[model samples]
Target: MPPQQALAIARAFLPKRPWGNRYDYYYTRAKLRTDPLYPGVLAALRDTPGPVLDLGCGLGLLAHALHVDGQPRAYYGVDIDASKIERARQIARRTGLKDARFEVVDLGARWPEHTGNVAILDMLQYLPSQVQAGMLAHVSRMLAPGNKLVIRSALGDDSGRGRTSKVTDLMAHFAGWMQEVPKSYPTRESLEGHLANAGLSATFSPLYGNTPFNNWLIVAERRAG
Candidate 1:
């Protein structure tokens, strides 16, 4: 790997330093090299024709990469921590990225206000249940029908009555910060329902094994005009 990429890979696994608060530090790093699905992420964003809003964007690496490819006209990252935002700013400046921007805001405190393309990577679970649904519904209102939402979240397995539910709940309880992730554990039926409820038609990609936890990538398009 090249020097910067090498640094990013090295930094990816560093025990979280005490510099920034928890989410900011981790999310920032995730934006850099933590996301192993960058090929898919790049493919999803490459064709988007509007300004991209990376909700809960940590260090802005995803957005920065998109900008370097000369794809998005503008890429904006909003996070709940200012320390991470400062770190993101530094990354932008060092890379000489101009079309990207970062904002300090707790999106869970309120729905993010942005139109066109959107990305919420492993951030849905961070919001309370109602907030997760509300954010999707809110985005439903903001984005046109042709727009897409790429969501990466944990799946809860609610297969057979009490047994699965208990297991799912146990997973959530132990997931800590990851608890917000739906404990369904990547079942198509459950994920499809979430998309259907949000007024989207969805297709899913199963990403499992060799990763920290089970995850599903939902690529959904708004169903109503």
Candidate 2:
């Protein structure tokens, strides 16, 4: 997203309260401008069908990005944080973003009933390895023909970039930006094996545009009959 467009989107998230509005504004702006996550996701989802189920959606930034990009898919964003969910709802309602909804749900315990494309971004490392495998299997099973499962995660590796990602994630946990320290990161082989076992073919590519984190974009779809 361009700086001006990111600024415009950030303005929509401005809270009515005086205390934390600045944080929301700047954080949203910075994430939008600097992070390549949204652009990568938006491109991956462009040809897929609606609606989209975004697991671990923080403050519904994807919803806003879709709205800005003129993708009219019905977006259902869920996260474990109640406060962020409420704030996302507020932003959607205030901005009149059609077909966007937000909810709070513990993904480790249960996933909402959804049938469409799915997005899991920057969240898989927080769960235990078994949970991550289970979640990937569940998510892969939800994919119908022509639908897609898009994910952005830091793949586990021995490289310096991988170490940087781990350190940054730890700092996020310490700063209270995340509820848990990252438990496990899935290696490329593990992720591919899990998805292959679930009957989906996947493609992986580097998503680290300007950021130093070891992020990779994985797009999976069911094989055609």
Candidate 3:
């Protein structure tokens, strides 16, 4: 869908739920969903035989967007924020998403032991470098042979040449916002190594809609033990 139309759809569907974080959310979701990376996620999400797991699923924007476009299977969105998860739960209820659920869980310390397709969006950066690696390892160990890990993150650091854009974006992201962006981000090389360390073969792709973003995605899979 066109970005404008998609934005409108998100705005329209959001208010029906009294608990949704309607402010600044549609803008974020609209940009992400219309992003090129979303098609890849859609294709991967469609192929999952079971549910999709959304880690750090703030306010269920991604989940809602997926449901809005058309997701074939059940999805579970996990997050650390109780209120956001509650909002997510409410959104699910209001939208009649029988296949989607939300819960408060921080996968950084350790993801709950469960098995299914999972998508970790822009959450790793918040974790310290070692923590991020360990988290990836935990997720990898949990994944089955066919289970997938879809990761998204902001990229560039300071130079905007993939060297320093992340810092810039983080500063810009929180300049006037209530919450600060995440920290402990791995460099591109380190990001790939995290997946490899976790025993998952991974590939990275760029996501659009934001400039000077260290925004890119990584998809990984676990091999049968």
- Candidate with maximal lDDT: 2
The 10-residue segment of model 1 with minimum total lDDT is 177-186
Rank by lDDT, highest first.
2, 3, 1
Q: Which ten residues in a row have the lowest lDDT in candidate 3?
A: 156-165
Candidate 3 ranges beyond 4 A from true positions: 1-9, 16-29, 32-34, 156-158, 161-181, 223-225
| lDDT digits (tens) for residues 1-225 of candidate 2 | 888889989998776776754777889999999999988999999988779999999899998898888788899999998988998898898989868988899887887778889999998887888888888788877787899999999999999889999999999889997786788999999899888877889999999998888999999998665
Give the per-residue lDDT of model 1 (tens digit) for 20-50: 4455435544444444455466677666577
lDDT of 3 by residue, 66-163 (tens): 76566656778888878777867875676677777888886665676657777877677777788888777877766766778888776535545455
Query: Given candidate 3, what's the lDDT at residue 209?
Result: 51
lDDT of each: 0.63, 0.89, 0.68
Against the true structure, candidate 1 reaches a TM-score of 0.70
Misplaced by over 4 Å in model 1 are 1-34, 158-191
Task: Report the number of the highest-TM-score candidate.
Answer: 2
| Models, CA RMSD each | 5.7, 1.3, 3.4
TM-score of each: 0.70, 0.96, 0.80
- Local error of candidate 3 at residue 26 (angstroms): 4.1
